[model samples]
Target: MAASSTTLTLRERWTRFVDEEMSTFVFSTGVYAAAICAKEYKELQPTPQRMQQALRKTGAKMPLITLSCAIGIAGMKMCILGVSRLREDYTRSSVLVACPVAGALLRAHRGPRAMAIGALSFGALGYGSDYLFSMWHRRNADAEEVRYALSLREHHNVHHNDAFFIETLQSNAYLLEASQK
Candidate 1:
């Protein structure tokens, strides 16, 4: 009986891992496509014809919106998988990224000065809330899937803000490398 139970557990874990990885891939790709479309739309300038064109382009392009939605769904799935696996490292990293982004958004919506203070305050609060909620959900629920999904949602929020950071980091690294030459 014990051996059979162990085999079942192992099988379950494997399945979950596979599902999560698939989800991560889809989510990442979708977000990338969506971001590209958004940037393109923004660059076109706001006119009735341009707006209609943008909408048509996005709607007609299967690869664009479909990829984004797939990515989002996949991310949520991966989060659930992580939580179920009790992977604290992944969860913590996710929280780190999510908290600051949430704060920044809150700040941005409030204007310049409020943006700074709001970012700090909201970021801390967001992180704390995430931690507490994760803990609570883990204890109270049969599965931590919902908690994991929420974490992934937080991660998506951070992902949206990551473009500037990524670009800056790449530029700085290039400059440093050039200086050393």
Candidate 2:
């Protein structure tokens, strides 16, 4: 019972993993979409034939692009979480490299246009996740933290502005700093 209490169950861990993956799907898909859109709509006015070609290409590439995006988001989340521990996050860094590397690979097998999708996604999602999580922490008060640590650990749905997020992040940082002492 003691051991079980200390470690997360498989279901809990899987749920957390799934939560992170789903939260960032929009950014990942956006990355894929941007590249696909750009490639598909390069010309000022596209013909019906051109539209069909672009749709076909973009559709075929979406799976790989989405996979790469999901990979990137997970890597980014791991890096941020590791940073919270006040140590080097080598694992996150390594995992994150997969995003661009996969993109480059897509470029090799697909086209330059396909590569853009991955690269864009890496930039958009990688950089954007910091903001996404900051937004999450901002909305939840210290009460939320207490509930999660002592009670059920679930994400809060309420949201606040950037200022709130910054203030909460600062307060959390202070708490962390004090804890280290």
Candidate 3:
């Protein structure tokens, strides 16, 4: 049982790692391709030869962009996971710990000032994203719980007014708060 559970955890972690890596790769590639197309549109002559050059340039650059994104995101995920393991909990703190390191690495080639800016920017983004996601999940869970309780109450009543019951559920404070966006 212990062995199986350990294997399951390892598998899940590997899945998460690969998922992040692949998603980052795909997203970066698409964005880069779009940027390349836009640049070609603005700068290149509208000729078959120019179009071919644009295609060739995109093909040449895509692998580099894809690899960079995949490796960078993978490294960031590893840092987050390592922090979570050390802290014995997965929380926003893990993102806070990882984002700066990832950001620093991202701008290291540009020297100290750029690296500092990147770290600060990435840290802020990570903090904001984590906070928003946590709040969103909490609201969703609260709304779901309210719905379940209301449903159970509905099932127990023999002569309840359907319209009134629905109105009551809709007016629930949790649901109201959740609905506020």
Indicate the TM-score of model 3: 0.54
True-structure lDDT of candidate 3: 0.72
lDDT of 3 by residue, 68-163 (tens): 455556668789889999999998678788998777665555578977897898888888888888888878777776787587776777455767
The total number of steric clashes, by the backbone 3 Å criterion, in model 1 comes to 4
- Count clashing pairs, candidate 3: 0
Question: Which candidate number has the best TM-score?
Answer: 3
Output the better candidate (1/3) by lDDT: 3
Best by lDDT: 3
Winner on TM-score between 1 and 2 is 2
Clashing pairs in 2: none
Give the runs in model 1 whose Cα sits over 4 Å from its true position. 1-38, 41-46, 87-181
TM-score result, candidate 2: 0.44
Candidates 1 and 2: which is better by lDDT? 2
Residue-pair clashes per candidate, as listed? 4, 0, 0
Which digits, one per residue and each the tens of the lDDT, describe model 1 over residues 27-107? 655654565556557445667766666656766664544543454344445544456466555655665554444444433
TM-scores for all candidates: the values are 0.27, 0.44, 0.54
Clashing residue pairs, backbone N/CA/C < 3 A, model 3: none
